[model samples]
Target: MKNSTLLLAIASAMLLQAAPAVAQNNVPIRKIKAVRPTTELTLLDRVESDTHRKIYQYNEYGYITSVMEYNKEAEQWVLDTDNSYRQEYVFNAAGQCTARTSFNVDKAGNKTTEKNKAEVEVIGDKTWERYYKEYPDSTTHISEAFAYDKWGNCVEEILYGYDSYSKMETIRTYNKREYSGPVDKYTDNSNYESFKNGRLLYYLKARGFDDQITMNTNELFVEEFRKIVWQTENDKLYRREYGLDRGMDIQVGSIEKNMWKSSESEFTLNADGTRPVKETVRSYDETGEVKYDYTSHTYTWDDRGRLLASFEYNESPSEVSYKGEYTYADDYAKTLSLREAIAELSCGNQIYPEDEFLQFGRIATSSYYYAEDGDKGESTYEWNADGQLTGGKWSETCITSEPDTDNPTTRTDYGETRVGYNADGHMAWKIDHSITENEFIKIEYLYDKEGIWTGEAEYDGDSWDGPWTKEGERGNARARKRLATRAATTPKFIDDMTDGSHNIENNDGVWNTNGNYNVTDGVVTGGGYQQTLASNASVPANPQYNYTDPLMPLEGEEDEEVFTNEAEAVWSYTWNPQKGDWESEWSPTEAKRVYNKDGNIVADIYDGNQTIVSTITYRLDDDGRLIEEIYSKGGNITYEYLPGTDYLLESVETAADNSRNVCHYYYSKHNYVDPTGIESIKRNDVSTPVWYDLQGRRITTPTSKGIYIVNGKKVMVR
Candidate 1:
């Protein structure tokens, strides 16, 4: 078998289909030992290596109370007292963990402790939990409270966190949910009557009973489609103005309570409740009076629920922003629409119709227009008989208005791409042609015998008659032989190029840095930087590998930690082949960076003379979620998310000329994750294992023997 089969076997073996060992049910695992053989020759000419062990202790209630780790030293197991070495837990009478403490030992034999404690309180219908963590240099306190209704449904939750180092107490999250009681039927003529009358329904702007509708009799459909958020300023300067203390018992003034920014959204749904028909959003700044920034989108859909047209609008100067229109085609000579096919399927008792069987929702053409400079573009698609996208053509026209000329200049660009698929429905090759640039490129995908994608080759021209450039060749014949030899001999620095463990860009059999100078493979050479496996043998004077690119880094120096929570100074040098060593000169294009406490880059300064080049600042909520990013150069970007969630809702980018571009993200509730359906089964030692194809489709009978998934493990069938 090949390495691809072995890799698949290892991944599939984790999904065990057998039942648990009943004999080991009452056996508590006390300790686990792991050993790895090393190649270091011992005094007696025997190999020696270190071993590791982990010891676990459990309380009477079957909860882990303590865990200790040890490493073998000179044939003796010694306690490992490094950072985060040991952990001890304290439990209450109800068998709930109340506190946890981790032990750390420094190089000077000094031990420090980090502790976390949680306290819970139960009031009338609410529960509160306060968690506190104490570190060596800082402390964090979080308070969470939840309120439940009569049916035990949590209706409200509030979370707050206080940071000692930042000396700020902030509201991390606040969310409230409302559910309607069981209703016989919906009688609201303003909203429900329109939906039943085959008219497009719009969500009402009201306080209660407007956001949701009743889907069926005696059932309430409460979906959260819109939300509003308020943000407050909590920088160091703002906290200092309030005279706040480091402790959590400080009082906050009215100035700190005032909202600095706020946003509101409205959503309108279609008739089938499948997708949104329109969305409107507005942002406000509340420094003095409210200043509004608004954007809106309206969509037109066909009878099959496919989008036909869309329009975007901005409210600052009240103008149209963008417009797009779409056209679709079907397999039936474009005569039968998808809506008619769906009607037939629904009447024929088809509850769920698969696309492979229906085959009616293929897009044909799409056109877009921008209102800023009157630019327009269009793309047309072609599909094969199997409904696979075969090729596409894109053309765009750019209009530029000149200050001195009355007539605007227009230029058009065109491009096309074609795809080829294998018998297994996997993309085999792709060719891209740019008529504007007069360039052509082709890429071919390589797969193993089992139809698993292994590598790919790229060609510069249209023909495939010359030597090709390859990448991701981990499972190929040549790479497999090299990997076997590497397994027996350990090198000083692991060469990621041939190890198949890392992704490196290889262009025409040459390893290019792709403009990133920070990468180093721990080897220095006169050519530049040769990332090769280290050995005792001397390197040839003129090696086969050539890396004489001037932009490549010969040496790198840093004044501070690069990616830590502070500023850093960096310098890079090019190779000086004449001097037979690295040059003392630095690249003027190199830059140093300064970071804030949140590890966000605050400034970028030129490294050659230490002059400020550009600055970037970020605003974040208490939960460390970025809200806005400001760039000193030209533009700023702001982000919005769904309330009490990390899912991004929208992002707006404003250019220096005050032109705004907005994007919205929508999620559907119908798409959900299915359970794995893994269950324990009785062990059968005499039964044969089942087999499946590489695509996870069950293989009923084997015509020819090859690599197949058997009993949830990949194996060769003889």
Candidate 2:
């Protein structure tokens, strides 16, 4: 991430406006007190979409060894550190992450480990995204860029996935005051806004997505939004919103009551004027199922609020309570396992929930909590001088401890991609990458006069490697293609490359030469990349699905499946050359395998060739991991793919004496059997896990070992 793009000066200007500013009662700021968020979830959309995040760290402390996490559904403790994360901390003589990194976790039998740093990058007034594990096959990174405004409203933010897929498979931006809600539906084209000078202004993008409604509803158009103060005989304040959904004209529909508005709405400033306060808000469903509710808040003393500790709650009568004395120590913040945090929150020990809507059965989206009975629990906290929490870990993986291995030998390299940026700080980019063990790659950008990226190239651990031609933009290179006859036997579209051939050397010490296999009218053809008959194979990530022999498509079925590269198909008959007409004698075998010009098949043909005739050739993923297989018998070639061993296919070769060769043995270090009685088989290569049996014997003893039951304590029988 680049600094200039974040615009620190703009943020400073807003906070430094000439208008009289609200000041905290002259109290010396201690460590930043507690900080809170509107809504928080362990995993967004409740999905474990982020499975391969890595971790990293810096600043003179050899502090945390690793961090891990368990999801909300976990019955017990779980680990989180499976990816690379970075931590930045300022230390005194003792090397504690004074300004950053604060959290802790609990160990099994009885010990507690602490973490003082998290993945952080502080540079100038802005912190760039650092401590990220580089992905193979990707020149652009999947990242979150942030910019804070005067009132703490996010001024600018971008979330994007930068690999080649669809034009907007990645890139989402959240702009405050500067833009309004997206009037479109392309995630990459979405925009948001704040207000300016009493007039409605917007953070706008001609291109981007606008939030859409479900099936039967109309699309809601954003009218206006932003925060600002106004004055008169009596100072007043408000958080305004403007909206429209299709046929309706734009109008102010709803708002978060009495905020930093120019005039007052429904609340008042008490004698304790600037002190922190909580205002509970509510919303309910038709059945009064207590759908939603949450406490609105204003932090009191800068660093004294406990953003992580949830206040107590009693439901039947409807009551909420917090702000209590710590039972055992001067310090109450502590780190716990994911389960520990949930337990405290479940009971009344932590998180402050505003109870105004107790009758409605609704509360704020996020809350905080600390441990209950022990000085030895899980969880940790960090505070700024004013006693405010800048940021802290949720689970240990939030500020975990793990062996450092930021630089990995493996990485992905998806070819070249272009990035586009709008004036409001919105960005869109495509990326090309690949995964290879023999090398590393860096993405390079080529810009046009407008400073927009028109070109993109790669540094293959060596030099700037540009693709052969430019796509549409200036510096980006895209391969060109031609759509041939659409009638019947033509492959969808042909990649009109100048020249090329498939030359592969097999274990038999033979370098096979390949040629084209294009179909024209009724004859199954040949022309381009060289491919053989018996030993050729398919490729991955991108593959061309072409039929070896033309066959009539199903009656009236224009489309059978989505395709990347397709050639016209035909019918196989018993004429002189053994090929004939449509319907009467033609039957369709759903496309199982696709091929390239060199006569070699491409992509995974798993589902297509499931009928399984005989021999097949396999195709690998971007990492050479087997993805599919293809089979051919003259004009009757078909493709098939199956679950495979990571390295090679495992099969039993019947020997004359009845002996079998076990080709592969998979291993799992983080192996765990779930409630379904099935054991997961991924590698532990990082954090270590434990397993137990009915008699309390440690069962995860390395070798796949003896017989083990499912979730029920396994009785190991040798």
Candidate 3:
């Protein structure tokens, strides 16, 4: 049986305990206080990763103020200086977070000023939160305002775009649900809607107060509608949907689900009330009616409540059926305890939900069988006393049957992985072996005093090797350690190479450094000489970036060097007073980029000295996919896409030769934003008119006037 079925059965048993003590089938349960969100991040004791580690530092108010990343070197944690990634938070006197800022360090180990990349400001204790993003020019890229209901649910959200003349808003309204004791059903009937440019884009209206049925094993009321939904498009009516639930009475060994027969779902819990033995799942047609096909599952568990075996019965003959069995370690409890102890010691602060203490045990080995022509697989796990999952091995065999032939063929494959952990429970060594290929790979790890993983080395061979070592040739490994707390430090030389040392000088308790460069006191100060690496790959070699006539490379397109090829390109810029930034426009001396209203790259201009070298302009279809690209160098490409779809490329045509390439496209599902929040207008492509009702159904016609989603936008039809 699927894990979900077991979870559902457990949920049903828990519900029975809600009845009066004398009438309840199970013993009364103790309730634990829920953890508050504000203190959750600060309460973490420690977090360790192979290459990085983040230590949460909190203030007196128990609010996280700074998150620092450290590097592990020589078995100790050291301040990482190579990567520029840090977050600082501020909280008000009320202990509520007031603001947060993120910063990054560059390859040269220069820490940018705080609040460089993005920031969020919280206002109005319980009602609203505002967020902001900062661009390279120290300007706002976007901002958002959110309003919350008493239940801490976001009820209204407004998004403000920085560069485009567009706005989006979302509003949600909810009603209190009625109580009917243990067997009663309730609904919030929350209404949600989204609008773009003051036009409705999406909506959902859900209603509640449904009659709940319970199964008595004899005339049992076993089904209930949690809520019914109505969906519409362009104010046109579409389809309706219902949310269902199956209730089981734990007192009696018998269970009946979906008694009302409105939806298709049934689950049965064993009289023991601890495990689920069987479950049935049904398919539904687009109209919300149950289909004839269904699936059944049966499960067997050990006396300790651990699932030992499971079987799935498929109603359809075309699909393969599944059966799996599990086993536990001989000393399962002792091993589990040791592992838990190591975890507790490593974290220092081990706080888990109250329910975790009573959770089920882990599996040691598992085997699976595919009944359609006999395919099988199995895996085994190994662990250490430190609670580390040391390594695992898996093997699979496939038996293939040929049509009209009595002979059957088989193939087998297998692999194994072994891992060793450090004293802190961090994985320090790993070796992988593939029996089919007769190949083996090994990796070694190193850390600093702070338990931050800072180095790694790898080797591959046909024969096995010894434990990890530090003297082997390095494998793309690097590390940088911070020297002081926001103070200038002298540059150091390691192996005669200038170490990329940069520092954050404290300016009135605010750590500040230039962004992507060496700077101090709000000035561009030079440190170790910096130079931009030129691209080594030929301009036309990189198909992903090189565009023909009428199509220029997008900004930052050439930054990626596929083969570490670098060539320097001369560049100069003209200042744009209007935008308060240095940019190349009228008298361009370097490359420049321009974006259209929908934020798509519209054009790229390349200038040499005072003359224009080349120009590329891109045209996009209504769905935002590139339809045509024009390059000044003499050639262009035009793209043809299917209409009324996601602009799937149907064909490509080159202007030079008129040669055509065609393709067929398929998609799993259309992407649509939920109505609970505003979706940014990233692409203003034209879309085919489609209608939908609040129930999320596609409607062909409108039966009555109402609010509906048309082409992903809201419309009111009368």
Query: In lDDT terms, which candidate is top?
Result: 1
Off by over 4 Å in 1: 1-296, 314-319, 331-361, 384-388, 400-409, 419-431, 440-718
Question: TM-score-based ranking, best first?
Answer: 1, 3, 2
Tens digit of per-residue lDDT, candidate 1, span 543-572: 001111111111111221222222223333
Query: 1 or 3, which is superior by TM-score?
Result: 1
lDDT, candidate 3, residue 236? 27
Best candidate, TM-score-wise?
1
lDDT of 3 by residue, 1-718 (tens): 1221111111110000011112110101110012233322203323344444544433333333344556668877777643324555554565444455556554343447544322234355335555556545555543555554344444344444343333222211222221111111111101011101011112222221123222112322223223222233332222232333333322111222332233333434445544556555655653556776454666776766655777777786334398878776543432223223212212221121111111234447778787866877776767667445566776778887776798898988787767676666666666767677775667565453345443344555565564332222222122223333223433321111223434322111111112122334543333322211111111222222211111111111122453332232333343233443334322324643333434334444445543446666666656655666667765676654333332232224355555443322221111122223111111122243476887889987656645567677654343
The per-candidate count of clashes, in order, stands at 0, 148, 51
lDDT, residue 470, candidate 2: 19
Per-residue CA lDDT of model 2 for 39-118, tens digit only, reads 22111001121221112221111222232333223354344432212233444443322243333334221223223222
Query: Could you tell me the lDDT of residue 132 within candidate 1?
Result: 52
Better of 2 and 3 by TM-score: 3
